[model samples]
Every structure is written in structure tokens, then in C-alpha cells.
Target: MKILHASAEYFPYIKMGGLADMLASLTKEQSKTEEVYVALPLIGKLGKSPHWTGKEFPALLPQDDKIDSLVVSVLKASRFLEAEESGLKLYFFQSDLFQTLDSIYGHKEEHFRFAMFSYACYALSQILKVDVFHAHDWHTALSLALQKDSALPIPTVFTIHNLAYQGDHPFWMTGFLKEEPFRLITSPFDHDGKCNYMKAGILSANQITTVSPGYREETLSEPNGFGLSYCLRQRTLDYSGILNGIDTEEWNPKIDKRIFQTYSFLDWKEGKLKNKRELFQEMGRPSLPLDAPLVGLIGRLTYQKGFPTFLQTFTERRHLPHRYVVLGSGDPEMEDAFFQLSETLPEVFYFYKGYNESLAHKIEAASDFFLMPSLFEPCGLNQMYSHTYGSIPIVSRVGGLRDTVEESNLLKFKTGIVFEPNDTSSLGYALERAKDLFQSQEREIVVKNIMNLDWSWKKRKLEYDLVYTKAIELKI
Candidate 1:
């Protein structure tokens, strides 16, 4: 099968979130199975090497006249070696009109920027002669709408990374469409009295998918769907979930060059102690005993990540004898709080204010336990990575955290721990349990369990292949 994968961001070139990592990993894995092609926006500043090679394709976009005759260019990606080796083609659209100096979204002409991307994707499909067009997130959702409206020959599949970030512009922005045609194109099922690009894709596509089975169920419910629950419920038969997988080659601690020492499940304890001591010295903390329970957190400092809940638990329970290290940057208030905690409780807390990919690997490898107290996560990769590194994850019982971690593994297999979301007391209880397990010499069992769990992209790629086949079989 010849597949054209369309996303707003791809790894190495442009990446602000997990979607880029997902695309890079999934595409690389899928390349082994089928003829895969990828197309994404050429945003931000990029080196001149991966320059455009294809001829411009004409496209009609909403609102702006300058964007009406947009020129779409195909710039091939060189980051994924497997993609290139398997004869998979990658393309990127470059147009000064679509490229904004500001953020990826939240621009004044946000609708037009993404609309150009959607149309460019369709144009690329025509030029490449793709059998199927796979669209990711709301940014490329409208491509499915365009294909359906034009009655494009190829089938399309849309994957929703996060339903919370639906691109909902004012209805007035869609003035380019005539009244009857607009109503038909932006059907009531597609719009929520406003222009919802994700909704349109969900309504138009042959299949709809989220990152996890737990997240799939959450999107069909009241609180998690963010007002798109009814629409998702109506199309329940067409919706499914495939849990996200990490590129084991990139994330594995056994061969990671970023760490002080490489280690596998067999010698994890000895190497982990070395990493833990190094982490302490680097963070300017006293090198505690090798058996000390070191907890690590690496994610955005936002409400969704349960930063507020973490603060409440740590502050309220002062007698806890665990060391914590955090590496992330977001929400100034949360950053400030972590800094203050690090100062006040210098012995127990260490905070790093920016993102460092190598440092993250070290933290994951060294830490006895990993923390992910997210209020609602959409198939978190960190938890899975932690498992591979033999760092037991103590996560909230929500979203992908729930799907990935099991209490049986925590007890018998000795993999990880779990707590209730949005509850500081529950987080404290789970932490206490982790500390107890650490003191009881059960940490070795936990590491053994975690090392056995596999989250390779090859396994996940097979699941995606099944979805693609089912998508083609279904008539839209």
C-alpha cells in the first residue's frame, strides 16, 4: 500500500510536542511494512539542505486572496534513516504566506495558515498518486474535508492526538463558502456553531483514532471530549485507539550515549546508582546513599501535568524522606514554586528550568522511580520510557497512564505505582508506597518487571497496519 502521512510537525525539523515524535517513530516503523510517504509544514527556520524540489501546485484557501493561489513545495525529510532506506518519500510545503514568525497556532490568520496546509496536503496526494492520505491532529484535519467535498479518489484516515486543542475559529472566517455549500461542507456534525477543524475531520474521514484505548473511551465521555463527546459517540463504530510507542533505539538506556554509564536489566542496579550519584552531584545536592529513593519528573510544568497537585502533596507532607528532581519549563508560577521548593528544601528537591534531551535520559536511567501525576494524559511516552530504563513510574490512574501501568506489575512484577488524579492525598499515599517498596528491597523486582515490558514501534506499527486495512475496507 502507498500511504501519504500528513502532519503539521515532523521530528528534527519542527517539534513542539509528542505528535512530532509519534510521526517520526510511526512512519519509520510503517516504512518496513508498506510504501510510506510523509508531508508536513515547513515552519520555523530550517537549514537550506532539505529544500523544495517539486513544482508548485495551485490551491484555493479560505479568507485571504494572497493565499488563494498558494504554491505547494515538496521538501524531503532526511532525519528518519529507515524511512529513506525503505523507499518511503517525505515532502514538506513551503510558502511565505503559510509560514508565520509567531507561534504554530494562535496567529491572527490561524485559519488560513492551516487551511493552506490542508489544501497543500490534497495537492501533494494528487502529485504523488497516493493510495491513502493519513492526517494527524486538527491542523491537517481540513484535508479530509477538502478530499470529501472534491470527491477525491483516495481514502483518508484522521488521528486525533488531543481533542482539547480543536481548531475552532469564528463561523464568519469561513465566508469563502456560499451559504448552502458552506452548510453542506461544514455540516452541523462537523461544526459546533463555530468552525471546528478536528470535528470536520472526524465527520469526513473513513476512520477516527486517538493514541490510547483509555483515551478513546475518554473522548466518548462528557468531561474528556471537550464538547465533542456527542459527535464522537455518534461515530463510535468508526473510532478506535492504538497506544503510542517510543523508538526503543532512541530511548533505551542500555546503549544511550547521554548517560554516564550504559546498562541493561541485568546490571541496572549498579549503573543506576552511578547515574543517581552523578545526577545528585550535577544538581549540587549531596550524594546520598545508593539505596536512597530518587524520584524524577520530566515534563511541562502545567496544570494538566498535575504540578499543582505535586506541590500540594510535597508541601503538606514534609516528613517524607524521598529526593525529587524536576526537568521542564512551563507555567511561570509552577516554575517559580519548584524553584522556591528547591531553595527551601535543598536536601530533598532539585529543579532544572529548561529542556535538555541528554539530561532527560540520565534522569530516566538514574532515578529509582519516575513521576507522572498528570490529571489527564494522552498516551504518555515518558512512562513507557521509564519502564524500559527500569525506572518504575508512579502515575495517576487516568488516560494512557491507566492503560500502560498495572497494579499487578507493581506488586508481583514490581514494575510501577499508580495514584488517583487531582488528589494530593492519593499522590502522597502512592509516594509512601513507593518509598516503602524501595526500603523493603523490592526495587530490584520492580526493575526486573519494567525491563521485561516492551514498547517498541514495530509492535505498534502492526496495529496501525490493521487500522489502515480496516480504514480502506470501510466505505465513506
Candidate 2:
């Protein structure tokens, strides 16, 4: 089957979150069975892809002259920068909108920029004769919206990575053309009198998917839905979730050169000690006991990541005895609070202000527990990474966190601890449990259990294959 995966960012080239990593892993694995093609918009700073085909396709729509002229200018100025990585064909669009922006998002004209890019992707997909157009997030939701009522034969599958970032624009952008194209674009995009790209995808897509089943269920309700619950419920038959997958090859602890030691579940204790020794030297340490439990967290330090719970838990009022190593940057208030916590309790906490990929791996290897107190997580990758690295995750019982981490199957593989009533007190309770587990002789069972869990992208790719097949079936 021919599948085209279109997104604004791709891993190792550009990334802001787990979306990039998930797509990168999925396409890489799916290429083994399907003819997978990736379409990414070029941010000028990243420059053209290393290997270039220098190919050009008319990025025009089946519309009139004036709109066609604008499309032609965008397409003429754009080049189809192509490359092959891990048996998948990658096609990147190098255009002024992406180049001038210098970032994947965060532009004042975000809606306009992505709308044009969506059109370009559709044009290229038609040229490529792809069987299915898989649009990731709202950036490519416009493509699905365009294809909804059109005579286009191919089917579209839209994946919602996060519902919070809907591409909402003024409803009057295309008010002049009250015909086919304008009507098509505005009709689905409209939500409470505004152009919401995600609503458009829900209305237009043959199949809609989110990262996890828990998240899928959550988005169908208030709070998590971000006001799109109505649209999602309207498409109940078409919507579902597939848990996000990670590349085990890249994140594996055994062969990774970045970690201080190479070890499996059998030699976990020695491996952790080696990594901890190196981490202590690098991040510095106080006079805490050698066996003090170190919980590690790596991601954006935001409210979504449960930094509020963290700061509250580690504050002067109610402090955690176990140490913490945090790596990330976001929301100045959260950052400052963490900084203060670390300063006040130097022996108990260490905060790294920004992200370090290698350090993330090292932290996963070194720590006894991985902290993901996220209030809401849509298939978190770090928890899985932590599990595979033998760092038992202490997570809040929400979304993917609850689904992935379970207390069942103690003799065999079991997931980590889950805390309810997401708050500082609840987090403190989970940490205390972790501290108890850390000192216990049977701790190896937990570590061994974590190592045995399958966190690979292989199984999830087959589900995607099924979803693609269903999309084609729907179109027929």
C-alpha cells in the first residue's frame, strides 16, 4: 500500500514534542511493509535535506486563475527536497513561508502558513498517487478538509496528536469566494463562528485517531476535548486511538554509547551504579547517602507536566526526602520555582534549566524511579523510555499514564506506580512508595518487570496498517 504521512516536523531534523518521534518511528517501521512517504515543511535554518532530488510539482489546486496564480508563486518558489532514510522516501517542501518563519510554528500567520502548506502537500500527494493521505495534527487538517467534498478519489486519515493546538483563524479570510473552494474550506473549519482546523478534520476525515485509547476517550469529553467534543462525537464511528510507539533501537540501554554503562535486567544494579556515579560527577552531589533514591524527570517544565505538583511537593512547606533530577525549560514561573527548590534543598533536588538528549538517556539509566506526574498525558514517551531503561515510572492515573502503567501481573512484567488525585500530596504519597520500593530487596523484580515490557514501534505499525486499510474501505 502507498501511504503518505504529512506533518510540520520530523525527528532528528526538527522536533518540539513526541509527535515527531512517533511519526519518525512509525514511518520507519511501516516502510518494511508499505511504501511510506513523508512530507515535511522546511524551516530555512535547517536548510534543504542532505540528499535532494531537485524535483518540482505544480502545487496548484483545482480552482480558478487568481487563486491558481498565488498557488503557482508559492509552488514555483518551493522545491520538493527529497531524501531516503531507513527505506522511507522523505519529501520536504522548501518555501518562503517556512524559511522566513525560521521555526515550525509560533508565527502570527500560523493559519495562513499551514493552509498553504496543506495545499502543497495535497498537490504533491496527487502527483505521487498515494493511496492514503495521513495528516498529523491541525497543521495538515486543512488538507483533509479540502478533500472532504472534492472529487478526489483517495481517502484521508487525520491523526490528532494534541487537541489543544487547533489552528483557529478568522472566519472571513476567504469570504470573497462564496463557491466550491471557499465553502469547502470554511464549512468544516467553522467552530462557534471561527475557523477551527481540527473541527474541519473531524468533519472531513475518513478516519480520525489520537495517540492513546485513554486520550481518545478523554477528548470525547469536556476539559480534555478543548471544545471539540461535539465534533468528535459526531464522528464516533470514524474515530479511535492507537498508542504512540517509540524506536527501541535508538533508545535501548544495552548498545547505547551515551550511557555510562551497558546493561540489561540481569545486571541492572551494577549498570545503575555506574550511571549514577557518572551522573553525580556531572550534575554534582551533596552529602546524601549513597543509596538515596533519585527520581528523574525529563520534558517541558510546564503545568501539563505536573511541575505545579512538583514545586508544591518540593517546596519548603512539604519537602520530599528522595532526590530529584529535572531536565527541561518552560514557563518562567515554573522554572524559577524549580530553581528555588533546588537552591533551598541542594541535597534533595537538582534542576537542569534546558534539555539535553544525551543527559535524558543518562538520567533514565541512572535513576531508580522516573517521575511523570503529568496531570494529562497523551501516550507519554518518557515513561516508556524510563521503563525500558529499568527506571520504574511513578505517574498520575490519567490518559496514557493509567493505560500503560498497571499493577497487574506481578510475577511477570508489570507497569509502575500510579497516583490518584493529581496534586502535591498525592505526588508525595507516590514518591514515598517509590522510596520504600527502592530500599527493598525485591526491587529487582520491579526493575526486571519494567525491562520485559514491549515498548517497540512494531506492533503499533500493524494497527496503523489496519487503519489505512479501513480508510481505503471507507472511500470505496
Best by lDDT: 2
Model 2 residue 434 CA deviation in Å: 0.5
Question: How many residue-pair clashes does candidate 1 contain?
Answer: 1
Encode model 1's per-residue lDDT on 397-441: one tens digit a residue.
988889999876435564578899999999999999988888776
Once superposed on the true structure, which residue ranges of model 1 sit more than 4 Å away at CA? 46-87, 98-106, 177-184, 187-192, 286-290, 409-411
Instruction: Give the alpha carbon lDDT tens digit for every residue of 142-187 in model 2.
Output: 7886676556656989999888888877777644223433345376
Candidate 1 similarity to native, TM-score = 0.89
**Superposition error at 211 for model 2 (Å):** 0.9
State TM-scores per candidate.
0.89, 0.93
* Candidate 1 local lDDT, residue 127: 61
CA error at residue 270 for candidate 1, angstroms: 1.2
